[model samples]
Target: MDGQYSHDSRKNILEWSLPVIDEKNKSGSLEFSIDGKPNDFFPVHVSFVSKRNFCDIQVAKVTYIEGGSPVRFSSETSFVVDKYEIL
Candidate 1:
């Protein structure tokens, strides 16, 4: 994820780019449809631990850029977690 977002030594931030899933997939495409009906084909679960950040933070704003120039783009951000325990 290096060089994906602007660098700042005095600020704490993270940047991520989700992959584009399609009908030719079996996971990570819950927001898309398969056969007119809401696609509910999640055959797996994913979880992980990282050293990036523990507490969730609110985003200030979003900017879309292309070829070093401002551009138009749409994005959605959410924090989805079923459960997390420290034991």
Candidate 2:
């Protein structure tokens, strides 16, 4: 995880979240493309270790370029959610 939000960091980084269900889809990962940039991409990993491990999730999707702003783009492809753990 990235460091706790500093005052300046909050102004640049954007975060998104989705609920993960244990019985439905407990653990998995998603690959996403940002602003249609090939070089700029990342993965979101999700897992359920234990009840004690329950936590909120925040996904950083984009960042401001050197002298430009980050824009939202269509995903080049899609990911299937198939991994899950039964409670």
Candidate 3:
């Protein structure tokens, strides 16, 4: 899954979730990209691994560039799973 949002600030929040049945291991990646000319700003990236049903949240900050203004861009990822019991 993927998504994107625009804000006039240098920081943004992201929320996501994942579920596992009887305890399972899974891995995924979340990526953020800024639409603008390359400057002295550092690129932002992250990775994670987890188990069971849980909610994941993170805050993404836009890189500050000299004489640059915040602009619209695409960036976000998430997932969900259903847990069930069997006897």
Per-model RMSD to reference:
19.5, 21.8, 21.5
Candidates in descending lDDT order:
3, 2, 1
Which has the greatest lDDT?
3
Ranking by TM-score: 2, 3, 1
Clashes of 3: 0
Q: Candidate 3's residue-wise lDDT over 1-87, tens digit each? A: 323333444564343334332234344333557665655333433333444225545444554497566655655545443442221
The model with the greater lDDT, 1 or 2, is 2
TM-score of 1: 0.20
In model 3, the runs with Cα more than 4 Å from the true position are 1-11, 21-24, 35-87
Counting clashing residue pairs in each candidate, in order, gives 0, 0, 0
Candidate 2 vs 3: which has more TM-score: 2
Candidate 1 residues lying further than 4 Å off, grouped into runs, are 1-67, 82-87
Measured against the true structure, the TM-scores of the candidates, in listed sequence, are 0.20, 0.22, 0.21
Q: Candidate 3 has what TM-score?
A: 0.21
* Candidate 1 vs candidate 3, TM-score winner: 3
Candidate 2 residues 1-87, lDDT tens each? 221222234543434334444566644443434465533333433442332233433344665678567766543333344675422
Candidate 2 segments exceeding 4 Å error: 1-14, 27-36, 42-87
| Candidate 3: residue pairs that collide | none
